[model samples]
Target: MRKRERENPCGVCGHYHKYEEGEVCETCGHRMLATSEKASVHFSAFPSEILPQFLYLGSYDNASRSELLKTQGISRVLNTVPACQNLYKNSFTYHCLQDDKSLSFDDANQFLENCERDKARVLVHCMSGKSRSPAIVIAYLMKSKGWRLERSHQWVKERRPSIDLAEGTLVH
Candidate 1:
């Protein structure tokens, strides 16, 4: 088992604790949700591997799960959403995009390219894994693998069928 986090965030009250799964959170006095409970779809429960071991895609919920990230050997996080908190900064390296309105793929893909070059396991995530984050991953594929947009989009969708790229994000 991974050692308990010395400053884990309590889901209910936002207080930090020395935390482990199934243990009681100090501030909220509520029992932590066990691992089985994290499988809910609403939780962005599992990460979709985009490049075998090197690249992964998930949601803010998955990004928040230190245990899950650790299990996957993910060492870096590319947070596509400005609003989602980088919850495990002490455990992972994070690159957060600043713009919420229209993110350019160039900057985002640069981060993805760097992680790939270093062979670091990285997760790219937004509020939900469905849209923003997947778009980012697709962009990375297009750039890194020299794939066209449609082909790249299809590739990620096949791996993570939950993806739903917003109409605004698609090119004609």
Candidate 2:
């Protein structure tokens, strides 16, 4: 229903089109209209109420992890993976233990405290973006929202249908 973005140059690759018929980007293979639609709809994901100034990028998947970091407006990135801490430390703002299976509430609180102090928009990343990272996010939500851990997890699940907290992670 909408027209393609042949007129606008691609921001990612910076290539222009030759004519009105040319809707796709000239340089990159990406579709112009789709990119514009995504840009327009992205702000809807972060609602003003429950949405944290912080983001939870979640575990070690290449796509979600990279997208979270490369997102348009992000202030801080926290790589919660211990194994790859040294690799991404210089690139990111914080690198805490990636203790996914056994995430302690204290650690979550401490991380949130740091975020509050810095006034930064934090993105918590792990590997799969499912279990480990969601657990920490759940912990944070529970602490901040005063909801039971299970309820907090449910709330996040509503927004991110794919999320599944690691086993035994629901207990506070």
Candidate 3:
């Protein structure tokens, strides 16, 4: 007589059952599942040091953003466009939905005011971490840090080497 085999937990369904590759879970009948990749978002300094802070989330959709926000203590989102409906589920009290069309220093300063008043850390994102996000972040640094525009641009670039704001686009 053969002994019954113990089962592994289904990655998608969380049910413990004996399953094989391409096998459906008995409870949910999900044929496929995946283990999430655990990745850390890299930043230049400790959380408290960066003023009116900026975080780069690389490339994540709404669900990922919501999950990360819960863990990271991010209080607001400076989104280039509004997230998908119910993306935040009313979790956050503040949002600044800006366009990617040539952001200015005044715009960034306005965003800083909201963050300062609410005591919230801010995140700015575009599709990639290269151009648009860096533009806004540089502007914020100029207003908050009193750094020369060129120096501010160099600062974030040294920490996040991938930043590549286009020529003549940074707010003077």
Q: Where in model 2 is the C-alpha error above 4 Å?
A: 1-50, 62-70, 85-88, 98-101
**Residue-by-residue lDDT tens digits, candidate 2, 52-79:** 5555454333322334454634555555
Model 1 collision count: 0
Scanning candidate 1 in windows of ten residues, the lowest lDDT window is 1-10
Query: lDDT for model 3, on a 0 to 1 scale?
Result: 0.53
Over 1-41, each residue of candidate 1 has an lDDT whose tens digit, in order, gives 22344344655335565344566544333344556754643
Candidate 2 has an lDDT of 0.53
lDDT of each: 0.79, 0.53, 0.53
**Root-mean-square deviation per candidate:** 7.9, 10.5, 10.1
Instruction: Choose 1 or 2, whichever is better by lDDT.
Output: 1
Between the candidate structures 2 and 3, which one is better when assessed by TM-score?
A: 3
| Candidate that would win on TM-score | 1
Best of the candidates, lDDT: 1
Q: TM-score per candidate, in order?
A: 0.74, 0.56, 0.57
User: 1-172, model 3: which lDDT tens digit per residue?
Assistant: 1133234564433445554355655553334423331233333222222342444322223223565665667766655433322246487544444443555557657876677676776656543455666677777777777888889888877766756678777666
**Number of clashing residue pairs in every model?**
0, 9, 0
